[model samples]
Target: MVRLSRFVRQTFLSFVAVSCVVASAPSHADGTAGWESVKEAGVLRCGAAVAPPYVMRDPKTGEYSGFFSELCRNFGQNVLKVKVEFVDTTWDNIVAGLQSNKWDLSMALNDTPEREKAISFSAPATDYNVSFVYNRNNPKIAKGAHSIAEIDKPGVTVAVMSGSAQDKAITAVFKQAQIMRLPGNDETRLALMSKRADLLADANTTNMLLTEAHPDWAVAIQPNPPLAQQEVAFGIRKDTPAADIAVLNKYVSEQVSSGAVNRLIKTSVQSMLASNK
Candidate 1:
């Protein structure tokens, strides 16, 4: 009976020790939150793309220099008082990187049902619209082609980037129109310049900036009205701490109200185009 009681006591002690270890395990939200991670690392890892005007990746330097990239840099360095590290990620992988905590934020993420489940977002830095563009001389379609229903007639050939929200939107709207899924925006633009496609629908902000720079190759607009005006915001992991998120949100809102964000966006867009030339 004495030996049995001693074994029972030892078993109880072992269980308690194991419980303490389990309770103290490092969690996904470890020592610091997302915001703190940026500060600790001395650089915010921002994911961006060469999606011209918004987040253009410089071909020559292999670095990011565009509206969204500048915006992230300015916000991190000035407002958040942290260093900014730009990570050039393709549009397809940006969301996954955010989920994996590989990238801290994205510059021009359009809020969608699929994305909402994956990441936390700041208040919209600006509104987003998908517009159709065509070559200036050919200008196959007018500016107001909002939906596939409006633009996708039998003969219309649409250029799309496969697996993009624009591509999904087009598929949802136009079943009859033939879609040419190009690899990227540059390819799509080439397709349009080469007269392979009558229309190219992409984020309106980007298309507008490109049109401003290269008036001959592309022009775009909302057909009747914008199909939807989505708020573009930075995407972080959805599990980010509330305190960190609050700080980021406050800074973004302040910048937006002060018009600093707008100015930054405009300047960056101009800078990107000028540098590209």
Candidate 2:
């Protein structure tokens, strides 16, 4: 009986030791599996949609530039210690691609409640607002039009990048005006410039560039209450661990605090201007 009791005690001790070892082992199940996979791959994939000053891609070289791309490169290199790959995408498919795991991150996504339902976001890198740009000489748009209502009239055609936040915003507000959903920024701008569209609905920053490019005719509506004001941040998979998001937030906060983001934006704007010239 003493020998049997000794064997039973030894078995229980061994079982407990094994359990402790399993419990203490690092878990990939804690929602950090995404980060683990990224680390294992040794490359962080960032989805890039061409939104000037936020993201830009060179047609000749296929190289990505602009603030968001630079930020993604920095995060992958400095924080994740991985090679960064820019996955070309369009605004229409940016969110869908992220959902499908085509990339680890989506750069310069506006954090809307609708998007929140689909994916999570890091802390905002910058504030964003939609604005309408039009040729001041166009008869469809009134001079000094201060509100969307002033422009939302019959025969007025508003052009926007398909599946963009601005497209959604203008679609919601413009009841009588025709909405032209083009596939790319260049197309939308061309629609406006060619007078096929009376107004171009896009980010205020983007409109600023357009207006600057054609100051003689381009005019951006400065609405008193702004339009679709929101936070622009990096998009991540919904299943990404909150801890991983916290790390990204910390990095974004540090960049914003140090004015690094502002500098990047300035550089991007300058580069865009130089390219246009």
TM agreement with the true structure for every prediction:
0.80, 0.88
Looking at model 2, the pairs that clash are none
Where is model 1 poorest over a 10-residue stretch in terms of lDDT? 18-27
> Over the stretch 153-188, how does candidate 2's per-residue lDDT look in tens digits?
999888999999998887887899999999998999
lDDT of 2: 0.82
lDDT of 1 by residue, 78-140 (tens): 865878888777777878877876667876887676777777676566777678887656644
| Backbone clashes in model 2 | 0
Task: Tell me each candidate's RMSD, in Å, in order.
Answer: 13.3, 12.8
* lDDT values for all models: 0.69, 0.82
Clashes (backbone N, CA, C under 3 Å), per candidate, total 3, 0
- Candidate 1, residue 149: Cα displacement in angstroms equals 3.5
Runs off by more than 4 Å, candidate 1:
1-33, 136-147, 275-277
